[model samples]
Target: MDLAFTPEQQEFRAEVRSWMEAHVPKAPLKTLEGREGFDEHVAWERELASGNWGMVTWPEAYGGRGLDLIRWLIFEEEYWRAGAPLRANQNGIFLLGPTIMEYGTDEQKAKFLTPMAKGELIWAQAWSEPNAGSDMAAIRSRAVRDGDDYVISGQKTWSSRAAFADWCFGLFRTDPDSKRHKGLSFILLPLDAPGVTIRPIRQLHGETGFAEIFFDEVRVPVANRIAGEGEGWSVAMATAGFERGLMLRSPARFQAVAQRLVALYRQHADTASPDTRAAVLQAWMDAEAYALNTYHVASQVIAGAHIGAEASLNKIFWSELDRSAHRAAMSLLGATAELRTLPGGKGGGEENAWLEGYIFSLSGPIYAGSNEIQRNIIAERLLGLPR
Candidate 1:
């Protein structure tokens, strides 16, 4: 496949870069985990929606440009290069939105996609329950069919963005007697539903972005179900493919981090260890390599190649690249790495940002089904090895 960008694509990149330069916040908004920060980010999402920049690859009927994946990559590169705010509606735009488009009925698409693209409703991923963190099939949450609705009763932990998100999508046991991945259904419910409760889970950085979502006989319409009654596992695996494979964690993000790491190393090269310098260069090279592979994948996807268990490979590579790049940043920072913000009233800089990145990078191996589970999937499914 040809790797060179067409003139049209280059012009699109220029267009995106210009828009971002004019619209991205002059100063970083507050941390998105806090109530104030969440509000700020939502407003930013609205701003993006105003320009139809919320999710470029989505069709125009859903408030997108109906662009290709290659354009999405170009958009992402421009977004990161401009240091744009993190996507507040990422759970919806990146994971569930794509899944719904593929599995949802026409009515379901009309009801959910427009609002999601407009940022009028934000979504959280309720994938992990107390008993079903990495082992998703161990879910005990049950959603019983009742007339026209499903009465959901269960608890979910480590639910990202639930504290302030408008809705959540997760797997539930629709059949009481079925075990493991069988008899499960993917359901979406509003957070403010009468019997629903949300308790924020503070992270190591003392942020409340993640939450514990409890559903006590929460009644949701059967129409909220994506796919058929017992087809949730398949639908959910499709969602996970998006989360682990391409959309959720774009290679442009690491490419941006690598640029920052190189800048930091240059600032501290006079006193940095040899190992630190070596790591900085390695991070830059890896980021470029990941970006190239992402483009190649996009080309194949355009040619109708579906992302499958190979998503596990993508997840492992990007997660480790993130961790290693951040580790190198911490090494370069030394004691200053502990400071959430810079000293001597220096204001927010790489010193402050590196600490946050370093802390978040630690979780890369754990989220999105965890690197361990991913490896098992690669070995058993991709490599065709015995379980």
Candidate 2:
């Protein structure tokens, strides 16, 4: 794949850099896991939308610049380099928005896309259930038809952003007799709907970035369904591809972390062990490799190529890379890594960003169709191994 950028692309990058340098918040916003932080992040999203940069890959009609995947990558790089606030509505803008654009009715698009871009509505994902974390087909959440409405009743766990999200997109078994991947329907529901309950789950870092949601005969309009009945599995798999391949974990994020890791090592290099230094270097190399691979994948996607099992490979690579980078950071910090609070407010009062990141990285292998499932896909599909 060609690595060179055209003059236009270079100019675009310059424009993005200038905009970010000028407008990114000087102080980092609080984490979006709490109510105060969530509102702060929502404001940031609106600010980004006002500049038409909330979702660059979206169509111009939807408050975007109608940019290509390559430009999106450039935007992400600049965004991270500027240390912008983490997106509060990432589930809406990244995973669900694309699926909606590809499957939603024109009316649905008009109703949802604009508000989502403006951060007027934050979205959470509700896919995993008590018994169906990785084995999604085992989902027991049921949505029974009732005239023009579907009554949903079941429970979903580990829902990211659910604690304060306005809406949710998830899979429900519409056909009670159906098993596995069959008889499923993709649907969107309001979080405040009657009979719905949300309970926050505190992470190891004492943050509630995830939650459990319970639905008890919650009623939603039939119009909220995506694609068609019994097609939820196929639609969700496509979203999963987007999650594992490009959007959910961007290469720019890792590259920025790698740069920080290197800087951290340099600060303590004189006293650092050889293995720690080696790990730091390896992290940087792996981050660069991921970025390059992403460029090739984006090129093919823009050329109308479909990503298959390679998404699994990409997921595995980046998740492990993230964990390894954070682990190296912890090692560099040594005993201080465990300190609830670092001197000079380095760890955000009770915990530092590195320690917080390390905690979050532990979940990387488990989410978005866990690393084990991705490896199985790689072996069975990509490598032609038996299941």
Best by lDDT: 1
Residue-level lDDT tens digits of model 1 in 1-387: 566889999999999999999999888887787788889999999999988898999999999999999999999999999999888999999999999999999999999999999999999989889989888999999999999999999999999899999999999999999999999999999999999999999998888989999999999999999999989999999999999988988889999999999999989999999989999999999999888888888888999999899899889999999999999999998988887767576653333877787888889899988999999999999899999
lDDT score of residue 136 within candidate 2: 90
* lDDT scores in order: 0.91, 0.91
Candidate 1: regions farther than 4 A off: 348-351
Tens digits of per-residue lDDT, candidate 2, 9-124, equal 89988988898899888766777777787898999899888888889999988877889999999989989998887899899999999999988899889999989988899999
Looking at model 2, which ten-residue stretch has the lowest summed lDDT? 342-351
TM-scores for all candidates: the values are 0.98, 0.97
RMSD of each: 1.2, 1.3
Q: Point to the candidate with the largest TM-score.
A: 1
